[model samples]
Target: MGAAGDMSMRCVLLALLTAAAAQPEGPRLISANVGIIQVDCCFNDTVVDHGQVVFNLPSKCLQLVCNYGKIIPRFLGDPGRSHCCEFDGLLYAEGAELAGHCVVMQCTRKGWIPRGDIDDCCKHCSVYDDPHFVTFDGYRYDWHGYCNYSVAQTDRTYNPEAGVFSDFEPCFGGPSCLGRSTFKDHKHTVISLGHSVFNLLVNGDPYAVPLVGAEPVRCSSKVHPVLAWRNGQCTMLLGSSKLMVQHCRHRLDVWAHPTHADNLDGLCGHFNFYDADDFTSRQGDVHPLEYLPSTFPHSWRTLDQTDYRCRQCKSCPPPRVERLCRADERQLAKYTSICEKHLGSVIDRTEGLEGYLETCVFDICMMYQDRRNDREVQDWLGILQKNVNMAHMIINLRLGE
Candidate 1:
């Protein structure tokens, strides 16, 4: 059963790899191109006398959700990376309101009905208003940070040993409420990339119409920016599907760098490609800490204890811990060395796949909507996924002065 669980983890990793590798080479996230929109979200009116109302949009359309029962984790990686982990730690999903437990059959249509708050449901992926808020302290997190944060991930588990995220606090402030802390000197750099939405139907064309939003509703813009976090004076925001097709494949991998500042928190919000810190000091006058929540698990120790920003606390070991043989007592050292080398591989491949996403899937979305070639559309998705999914990430952080 344990092995079966591991296999399931691997399958999820493969899907993430596919997403990373399929990075779109275009302008950040274009509202018309990528990201999710809840407003005007279509849903069939369940006129049934006591029928429930739920947002029946695609999992992608849902940024965050809340409901009862176990949390069904989908994938955890960068916005455009192929590498994803099974959230070895716990995983938590929040809800605006919790409806009574009931069974939902295969009802698939788009729109929302009146049942309760938006939080009373579960899906493949979930959104955290201020993903970093669930923490004990105030600090927003990034895509990579949430994926790799041992404490946050562990809390999601339904195990008594894993504990519940009740105190996890509900997030409501939108994506950027948490400060954005990037790799190295908190300098703001805008990176452009493409976005792709795979057409599930094999017979439909990849570029066929109905590209996001309702068929009759015209999309205002192609992309938009979502504020994910705040870090002191330095804020980080991620642009979505706003770029051209060619640049979409450029994953955030290249953004990885180092910092030794005091606000490193349990897990540096700037995750991916490397686990290095980029802040030198919270009082650096350039970077400052906020009252946001990012309190983390002790398991997430700092890369360097001397880097006052990072405090070593309890942390969960990597999944491959047993893979390291005690016979090779030195494997502990080998483990760190390997992680340093492999930690960010997911980012690299995800970045690589971004190009393919632009060329094959996203760029032709409009074309597919009009052409309606299901087979061709499925073929594109197949190629993109086949090319993108992979295991683990390659970390390549070069220490600097």
Candidate 2:
């Protein structure tokens, strides 16, 4: 071979090596030699040991269907809604370009495949593709928003038979300015309660009780007060407001009932007012389930004389008010009566109640006191209690025999 030819070949080889070294590490070459890409970007690439593939998406554009299904992406033109479709262990990627768009897929023997062009992964509601907002139960909202106020709402109906609500109506605003819908809020409220109850039951009360110890645990039940909204103010649900001294015996109870700390000094009250801040401004705030009375106090009166007096004294409205209905009174009366008539010895017959109450009251009280200054903490406790109550209702429904 000639020296000129050899020199040229060496120069060409050097140039190729330099070009390869200059390329950025982020993008995949997508050539025969590169079948997978792993970069420090948002996408999480995964190839299961069992030959299945998994990838992380921004939650807005793509979602994983079933655990083992193949994934495919589709793209349409202009404001297109793109998605990753999963089929029999295979994937298809398609891109969309139109606003208010979605990518749809059809299942076939060949694997899950994109349905020609123009179909969407979402029906009724537009696909949520924002970086910060996400869809839960078909409502899109930024979880970071104040008290979940960022959640978007749409007009929809509930179908008890299917155990799920129907698709939401098209939101009037362009996704960002939508208000939370009534149905979505209600459903989410129920779900949130269930989750809180499950956590407390698993990690708070039931597990806190000691199995073997010298201080054998004893649990007792009592009735806690119920508060509701009436006449645009916070008041007792079914109890009367007028005081009955000698002739009228039933107490004309008020908000912040058991007004005296002495009333809450017993075992049942200990759990009821089990706050570390029992001596502070936050006293009587936390009422945990483990410490909740088995029997609930009920009345047919609606006026809140005590709360009214306080409101009148301050000449101000209640700080926070919740919507209430008469039906809840029956529920309150029924649940409170569950263990009411039983003798004090019944605590000995109750299995695991003592331990649960002790641990739950201790943990929750300490937690409450620690965060007593933070109003948000109290808000969280109230929300969690609602969930626990719902969970109890569910269990009672299933095993109320």
Candidate 3:
């Protein structure tokens, strides 16, 4: 009995080993007497026990786990592992496209991929305060003239759909302030601001803000081509372009789409990306920086015989010396401290910190030169400070998109 039992047991063990060797290499299954089977998963040349998690995987967004001899992938939802891209504090899902002020970005698994032509969006130009003009190319200059001037105009041969005219007048004891702006697109839109009241005119008829029209003249309160009045500011949109007029500040901002890039001729300058060629004359000649004070601005002046303001476009007073407009060291230090505290980050982002500081110094010097009482000077300075703050807010609101 002992010899036969031993031989049969040995044959059974040999047959089990042969069967295991003949099978394909895979998870090793161990059978226990309690009828439980333990399975091990093989992944990347490493063996993983069942129900064990593998944290350090190739994709940070995914985690691998061994379950029943199979490798299962699980999303970790780790903060560092994001399938979306964040822009301007907003999250864009993967494969999503976002079009902003000057750029178009697409969200990918890795990050945000910029797509399409970035120059497709509109560019900004503005005139504010004592008539400081920032051209579409970011050139800053001042032109003082009491006349109706062309702010922007499209060469009829080019687009024939866009034009902007501004009326300059003496106001707030300053040399010039933009009192009225006439925007000529498919429909004639006029914005007149006087005594803190803004009036809108469409084709010689009085129209209110948020007016809606058909095809060429579309203005709404919600969508594009919006004409809305809010917070003492009137915003007018005309075919992918926008114009904003701020009451009591004499500020006007123009956002022109890329459609009018090289086809524009006026005080707003050519919409080309280069600031050096911004001072192109109405006669179609690019002027140098030296002409910014006189030749360039005077070139865009309208000589309309029927308009009284156009007749007064005589030679402007001699260009004021900027050096003389610099404030004293003590006053400059104080103003600089204030500006650094209030507008440092904003101006730096806008690439206008140095320019704004210089403007502040000039304003201080001019205020002192006027020989106003201390209280009046402080009041004027306060107004300037408010304007700077407003500019900061407006930039963030408009460009944060």
RMSD of each: 25.7, 26.6, 22.6
Per-model TM-score, in order, reads 0.17, 0.15, 0.56
- Backbone clashes in candidate 3 total 0
User: C-alpha displacement of 275 in model 2, angstroms?
Assistant: 32
Q: State the lDDT at 3 in candidate 2.
A: 79
Most lDDT-accurate candidate: 3
TM-score quality measure for candidate 3: 0.56
Go through the candidates in order and give each one's C-alpha lDDT. Answer: 0.23, 0.23, 0.56
Residue runs of model 1 more than 4 Å from their true location after superposition? 1-223, 226-266, 269-323, 329-401
What's the residue-level lDDT of 287 in candidate 1? 30
Residue range 70-129, candidate 1, lDDT tens digits: 112232232222211111121212212112211111111321111322111210111121
Q: In terms of TM-score, which candidate is strongest? A: 3
Per-residue lDDT value at 77 in model 3:
50
Candidate 3: tens digits of C-alpha lDDT, residues 1-401:
26765575446435534443343445667777767777786654567778776332222334446666665554445323436544332345567775533434466664444344424356777776667788888888777666777788776222235577777877434456677676664343443434333345555455444222111222331112323333334443333333332344456766666756677768888778788888887667778865237777776765432356456645554335333344568877876676566556656766453566666555655556666666865675566666665566555543212
- Location of the lowest summed lDDT over 10 successive residues in candidate 3: 213-222
Spell out the clash pairs found in candidate 3.
none
